[model samples]
Target chain A: MRRLPLYLMLSIAALMVLFPLLVMLSTSLKPLDEINHGSLFALPQDPTLAAWTKAWGGACISGTCRGLSVWFANSFAIVLPALFCSLALGALTGYALSLRTARWVDMLFAALLIGLFIPPQVTLYPMIVLVREMGLFGTLGGLVFAHTVWGLAFVTLLFRNFFLSVPRDLLKAARIDGAGFLATFWHVMLPLSLPVCAVALVLQFTYIWNDFILGLTFAGPGQQPVTVALNVLAGSQFGQQEYNVNMAATMIAALPTILVYLLSGRLFVRGIAAGAVKG
Target chain B: MQRVHLQGIAKSFGATKVLEQIDLTIEPGEFLVLLGPSGCGKSTLLNIVAGLEQPTGGRIHFGDRDVTDLEPDQRDIAMVFQSYALYPTMSVRRNMGFALKMQGLSTAEIAAKVADVAKLLQIEHLLDRKPAQLSGGQQQRVAIGRALVREPQVFLLDEPLSNLDAKLRADMRVELKRLHERGRRTTLYVTHDQVEAMTFASRIVVMDKGRVQQCDRPEVVYAKPANRFVAGFVGAPTMNFLEGELALLSDGPALRLKENLLPLPGLWASRGLQVGQKVVLGLRPEHIGLAAADDVGTCPGHVVMTEPTGPDLYVRIRLAGQEVTSRMSPGQAPSPGQKVALELDGKAASLFDVADGQRLN
Candidate 1:
């Protein structure tokens, strides 16, 4: 059939895409000796749950064997409030920008959108100093603040483009129906923006949960998130290099984001199609 | 209901003047229609009255209260937009009762008012449904019901029926008249449809180029338009104009064409016109009738085209080196190239100066 080569190409691309994930999953099940002596692609003849248990319960980091539980809680403490604050601010800012009351509003929005381009890695130094000056360094609050600031540009852009699709007549009708600014947004605009909100929440949650540099830089030792803790576990200085445990720890650290993608995939595509790409 | 007055209203957007020195008063309980083509600033004028747009320089008074600087909610005005602008997320009951709820009315009172309006509009069965679930006609009824539930000082409708189909638009026009009669609400409607303006307006204000052309009863506007633009803009099939010069016949003053002479009444010169002055003779198509061929004193012409619309025939006649249309009864319709004579009702005709478009008599 003429479709043979096309299907072959697609099958190759899919294998390439799933190859790393399969290696991680298979490697995490092997014991240390088999992982060392066997071929890289060999199936583990004797698989064990020791690495998973150790990753969940007893992986040593910072002279402690507390595993990922503490750091997972730390990430949650940093992420939940940060997600809420960033998304709330972003939705309000986007709604205001979408109103387009004056010529200068466009200029202001352009200036704000400039933040989306400059990489957060470049701004980490200034952010550290800003967090320190505010007396938030090494605290969960500091990490939350850092993540919220980083996510604001993206979430704001998404919500602004989404709200722009609503008709001007609906807003004017609300105004004439005696709704003030806040009431109009709460009763009308908010109810219509549920899909876009889901997209923003999923995206922001994954971003904040997976962030390593911001958590390691601002979180210091006591408040470090799971990503930072996993880094410490993988790069242990005194132990033999245990690739299976490192791979298992990496899988655990990435679970939330993968789950988020699976849950919000369809709505994420809809959001991108609704002008988030332009934003 | 309250009398609404817009005094010396002027609005300019970045040097593009929209409305200039518009001063009009809408009487209490009067159904006033602002009729104009697009970009003529009719909707802008309505928005200004609704307090949605601030005028560059003006004052608006609803009854005795100056509301020029007030917000739309504070102005005691309710408006229905062209799109029927119902809140998509709310049910029909909530859509109709939103203004009352915003006014902080008790739940029972809001429910009572919304129910009353829904029943009156015959939308009681649709109360639980959203706007998207309703047909265009049903959505329009709900929009009107929303405005009625507010009981505001003024009801402003901005081309509300313009989005409906032709048959539905006609039905809505009749319903709008009936609604105004039953409620006796002071209403201001804006549309470019001359048929809607002619039928639904208690008084019609014809506007063009951001200025008022004429504001009077529809019958007066139909019989005697202030200028040529009003004459041509407000009528169906359009008024016809023939260029000629004023001359004195042996009997009296008359309009002299290249091929025929049309007699003018003696009192037509009461505006101090004289012979040899160029004028345009304005004639409605319905006023021109087919005369018997070979009749004395009749202008003979040939039909160049004919279009029959079941109820009436629009026959095109080539008369005096020009093509013009005449509305005739269907039984009297003529075929193309048929010989016929044209007769004008002199008393019902109008004349305008060749230099200016102002009416002569």
Candidate 2:
């Protein structure tokens, strides 16, 4: 067939991407001795759940044998509140800016867009100083605040662009129907923003859950997230490296984000392309 | 019903002037239509009246209550947009009842009011359907029903029928006129379609280039336009124009073109015209006819083209080195390139001065 070359190229590209994930899965299922004697890409000869059990419960991380359970709980605590705060503030700000009341409003939107270009690493020092001044430098609250601030620009940009494409006459009709700002937003605009909200939710959830630098810096003792715990478990520096437990911990830490993408991947794609074309 | 009054209304967007010193009053129960071509600021004037856009310099009153500083909801007026603008997410009942619900009326009362309007609009069976599920005509009726349920003091429509097919537009026009007769609200309508204006409006305000050219009844505007723009903008198959000088012939005064003369015998529109004064003669297509072959006072030209509809024939004539069109009965249509004697009826013609395009008589 004429399409044989195309299919061959696609299969090679797909295998290249799936190889590391396959290795992680295989290594996590093998016993310690089998992993030590086998090739990195080989399948397990005798599969066991011992490595998974230790990764979830008994592995030593940061001078404790309690494993990743507490840290996994900590990630949920940080991500849920941070995601809520960022999405709410972003939606409100984007709705207000979409009204296009004056010249200064456009200038303000342009200023917010500038925030998306500067790397978060560039602002890390200023953020640390600000959080220290607020008396929340090492607490979970400070981590939530940092994540919300870093994510605000992206979420707001998504919502504002989507809301701008709404027909102006809809707003006028709502006004004539006696709906004020809050009422119109609740009854009209909010219902129409479902796809955009789904995109923001999935993205912000994955970002906060997978973040390493901010979690390692701001999380106090006994409050570190799963990513920080996974790093400490893999690089203990004192014990002989247990490669199987480390791989299992890595897989457990990544499961939430993978599940999120699977659940809402179609909506994410649709939302990204929402306002680029009109019907 | 409330009488709507606009005084000294003016609008300028940054540096571009949109409307200039527009003043008008609509009596209670009167239908006043603002008729103009696109970009002539008719819709801007309507938006100013609706309290949707504030005028740069003006005061508006609805029955002695100044509403210039008020928001649209506070002004007690309803509008039907060109797009119909029905809420996409709501059912037809909810769309019509939304304003009443905002007023904090009970659910039972809102339902009753919505039902009454739906029944009147003959959309009772579509109460549960969303706007996207309906056809264009149904959406238009729902839009009107939404406005009607509010029972506001003033009603405004901005080219509401422009998006429909020709037959649907004509049918809706009659329906809207009947609705106006029943409700008798002080309504302001804006459209570029002259037929809609002529049929629906109690008084039509003809505007061009952001200025009011003529404000009168439909027949007067059709018969005696105030200037050249109003005459050309308001007619179909467009009024034919001939630039010439007035000459006093042996029988009477006549418009003298290059090697051709059209007799202007005792025409009221040509009163006080001095001999040899430059003027433009405007004649509608139906006013020119095929004269008897041997008639003495006729201008002769060859037919350039012929367009035949069922009841009428429009023949393009090449006369005096210019092309002119004449509307005749289908039975009287001459073939192309045939010589025809044309008769001009000066009684219905309008004479405008060549210098300023203003009516001379």
Model 2's number of clashes is 0
* Poorly placed runs, candidate 2 (over 4 Å): A276-279, B269-271, B292-296
Candidates 1 onward: DockQ, in order:
0.82, 0.75
lDDT of 2 at A133: 100
RMSD of each: 1.9, 2.1
What tens digits encode model 2's per-residue C-alpha lDDT throughout A82-116? Answer: 99999988888888888989989989999998999
Q: What lDDT is reached at residue A150 by model 1?
A: 86
TM-score, B chain, candidate 1?
0.96
Deviation in Å, model 2, residue B61 alpha carbon:
1.1
For B1-361, candidate 1 gives per-residue lDDT tens digits of: 9999989999999989999989999999999999988999999999899888899998999999999999999989899999998988899999999888899999999999998888888999999999999999999999999999998889999999989999999999999999889888899999999999988888999998888989999998988888888988988898888898888877656678875776544425657877888888888888778866644445678999998888889988987778888999999988898988777666677787777789888
Q: What lDDT does each candidate get?
A: 0.87, 0.90
